[model samples]
Target: MTSAISVDDVHFAYDDEPVLRGVSLSVEQGAFLGVLGPNGSGKTTLVRIMLGLERPDAGRVELFGQPAETFTDGTRLGYVSQHSTDADATMPVTVREVVTMGRYAHAGIDRLNDADHAAVDDALERVDITDIAGRRLSTLSGGQRQRAYIARALASEADLLALDEPTVGIDADSLARFYDLLGELNDEGITIVLVEHDIGVVTEHASTIACLDGELYAHCETSAFLESDALERAFSSVRVANAHRPVGGD
Candidate 1:
């Protein structure tokens, strides 16, 4: 019933080049909203503006009814960015340590309290990474490492989880398992916003879809979107084949 994220007529640009033009969307609470777009379609830029990491040239963004620029409570919003091999390659921290870092927003300058420890433990278990909680982050496989990252976000007990291209470079088996985990989390009532390029996969999992190609082509229920011409407008070539295919089918 409540909106987790609301973007109203947003317009953004990089220098002289326009990126997003008149984009508007509203993601309801507990909704798994998938963002699909081609390269340079401003999907990531729109997410950044929603997270307050970047400002839009025009229009306003709200998170949980509060202005994105003014909302300072980050503990309630969790984010997992695109694969960053550089940042993870040289890290020396353990999985538990990484997950514990999420509590920093709440704990501030203090040490981890009892509640923080409980949260971290629960998160690790939720992601099925508790067995490797003490393992070095750099030593784990790609799938395990990604689970650790998700655990870190979960430790914050965030109500909204946003991921940008989360399944990139992972094996098919791992990707399937990861999507299953996301479904479990969503079942627990966490609002999910996923930025993905794969139309079939996003359609299968997300309840709502937003197609962006510098402009908002469509933002509606996944079923409605699949039945409309919006996908053809935004992604004419590759998506044309999958546009009519029922979601979750080959």
Candidate 2:
């Protein structure tokens, strides 16, 4: 299989506070990779780097065989950040309008033609949000709002979808349905990089697992990851470190 994302000895920091220390991994095409880590563990930072939203201080990153920094096909990549829905809470946009924004890159200055409209329609249907396509985004529940976002990605025909804690604040049923949608998308050959804190959910759905704590503890098949001591080693270190930190230390 082709590699969708490649990271090698990547290093990054927020000023003097080191976040990622020589992290390395590769995500193959058509694979669902679940990134597991505790809070402040660089999971979001690493995913941002992978999606070219942030630059690494050292080492390299490649997306779809090209350098991530130089990869310019915006339509091929989709990202839903941790606070994506929070920003949409007050937007006076309709679900269909939000999904149609994905086609803007392809349409450029030209108005969307028949093909573009079809794509938007298809995306809405695929995500099962066609029924709510005309509803105001703010009026929908968390899960419905998330599905709308995913529809937007699908409308863009994204090859790689990277979501960071997308299920945050969502109900349990919605969470399950959201993962089910992801599974269907992955089966249809879209590469997925999901940065989520729910280890049980990740282990249940993702084909592979990448455990991290400033550095990568393991990157392997989910089954293999479960058999190893990676989670114990990674989370135990977090507990130990937190125990020693001052109440208000940065």
For all predicted structures, in order, the TM-scores are 0.89, 0.92
Candidate 2 lDDT, 1-250, residue by residue in tens = 6599999999998987889999999999999999998778899999999988899999899999999999999989988777765558787999999999989988999999999999999999987889999999999887788778878988998999998888876777677778988999899999999988889999999999999999999999999999999998988885548856789757
Q: Candidate 1, which segments miss by more than 4 Å at Cα?
A: 237-250
- The collision pairs in model 1 are none
Q: Cα miss at 44, model 1 (Å)?
A: 0.9
Which candidate number has the best TM-score? 2
lDDT (CA) for every model shown? 0.87, 0.90
For model 2, the run of ten residues with the poorest summed lDDT: 80-89
Tens-digit lDDT track for model 1 on 1-250?
A: 6599999999999997888899999998899999998777888999989888898999999999999999899898998887855767787989999899889898988887999999999999987889999998888887778778888899998989999987766778778878888898899999999998888999999999999888999999999999999887786643444554577755
Decoy 2 TM-score against native: 0.92
